[model samples]
Target chain A: MSFSKEITIAKSSVPKVALLVLATIFAFGIFEVGFDQGQLFSIVFGEQAYADLYIHELTHDMRHAAGFPCH
Target chain B: MSLFITIILLSGCSAGVIHGLVNLALVEPYLDKAIGIENQHMFASGEAKDTSQFWAEYYSYRAWQKGGQLLAGAILGTAIGALFGIVFGYAKNILPGNSFAKKALALAAIMWITLYLIPFAKYPANPPTVGDPETILLRQMLYVSFIAISGFGALGFYQVFRRLKSKRFVAVLGYAGFIATVFVVMPQNPDAITAPADLVNGFRAVSLVGVSAFWLSVGLIFGVLWQKLQPDRVKQARFQ
Candidate 1:
């Protein structure tokens, strides 16, 4: 499809996608910090690991909400 | 139920691939760089016949070692984001228009990053014993660049979904799937995880988060710069 059409569609959908991304971030964040389940938390980054894998997931969500793939 | 199961399995596969690459190939070298111990000897330590395990162990160690700042950043980002979401509760407040420019810029950035904007070091750590170090690092750089760029690509995909009649639940599914895969699939134990690191020793803590934060900030900063550089024609379209 034309670039213009994609933009128009993206513009129209921005709010919804952004909202969803925001919600997902919130849900995961709260769960990770508030609950702090040892088994799940440790496993997520790998042993001796300390990353919040959800960062990628949240970025993925941001892409989702933005309306199109980067490529 | 069947469809959900299939989706779950597929998600796991994607995440598993992402996990191995991030930890082993990326994290290992960075940790070694930080501690001045980057080398390929660690990969030779065990039966890590596969490169995947090497990378996973490297990343896990760094992740476990994160300092207080990153922990605070992640926590802060989550809290602030949630508060913003709550304050801007209405759907209308979600996104802006004329997103093409932002997307186009994002695409251009990814492409450029894939080609350039990558990391290099004084010495090769993992410097795989079998392959030439230069060739190994080049291939690793390309792979990581692709993965980083893929982040924007995934977002663009979601944009299309919203344009299509806009199914709320499907979007939610996308988010849930992403979160579950990332949070649950990463390795917890450096030794237990099958991956091996080319680096000589364990790295400082929280290197994983540092890597992502650096990249994400790059995206955000690039996004901001693009927003500034963009002509009024594009910016005006967003509001129209």
Candidate 2:
């Protein structure tokens, strides 16, 4: 008995859903790591989030290490 | 389709974790040294008190920030990897390499040069004590804008590169000239460097190493995964 394998190449078009997902991840992750000034947590925590700077503090070291503007 | 996304995300996450670990070991020392300088300035200016309470809070938060370094690395890595995957999906065939792994590595290097090194040359990374709080927003805008210009500019010139089969060198020269012009036209980082030269220089050197590791790891991992999985192909069996 002999076995043969057939390979079919798919279209080159990048899936739209995949693109959207990747784009969203790109935006959200960059904002969180590079530019977040407590804006994320502010949704629930309100003004206190800005003062607390939870995301800012959490990402502080990486912020500087990764070359983003950090105070 | 799911497999493609999985490979992209997994490679990104893994590379990012590696980037975080690398930062922890190599970059953390510089961060501590710089933050120490910031603490001394705070004490001198009465922005913070040098007391047991302050020390306690400081240690606690420093621990938290250090832990977050790894988390942030993974996050940033994934974000960058997503962008990489999108590009690879489109440009894999056109890229100059015989294998997926080679192609991935080539693209990674290009991105590292265009998106990172060039922008970094304009606005190099600084330690914590270097920047002024007042000018941070402006600095951020400048940095992001420069990276965007470099990235999009490269993309635009790549089109010219594809169109001109005979003298592709012109595309390279054109991009170089365009970026040089932008570099001159762009505003400089408004904040002055107040930190010690040794600390700032050391921090930037190590930061470059950490980021370089991420790009390398992402390229290798993503390429290997893509090669092994062949997510874009479907295989069927026929028996005779």
The reply for model 1, stretches above 4 Å from the true place, is: A1-71, B1-156, B175-205, B227-229, B232-240
TM-score (chain B) for candidate 2 is: 0.96
Tens digits of per-residue lDDT, candidate 1, B1-240, equal 222222222222233233333444445454336333223344356534446766786556446533322343344344333323222222222333354334433433433232223221111122112233235335444433443343444455456555668565576467446534643443221112122453322322223333343334433433343344422223222223
User: How do the residues B1-240 of candidate 2 rate in per-residue lDDT, one tens digit apiece?
Assistant: 899998998899899989899899999999999989989999999999999999999999999999998889889989999999998898887788988889999999999999988888899999888988889889998999999999999999988998997989899899999999999999999887878899999999999998889989999999999988879887667677
**C-alpha RMSD values across all candidates:** 18.8, 2.0
Q: Write the per-residue lDDT of candidate 1 for residues A1-71, one digit (tens) a residue.
A: 22331221222222455555555655565444323324354665565333454433222212111111211
Candidate 2, overall lDDT?
0.91
DockQ of each: 0.06, 0.64
Clash count, one per candidate? 39, 0
Over A1-71, each residue of candidate 2 has an lDDT whose tens digit, in order, gives: 76767584635568999999999999999999999998999999999999999999999988888889887
Score candidate 2 by DockQ: 0.64
lDDT, residue B1, candidate 1: 22
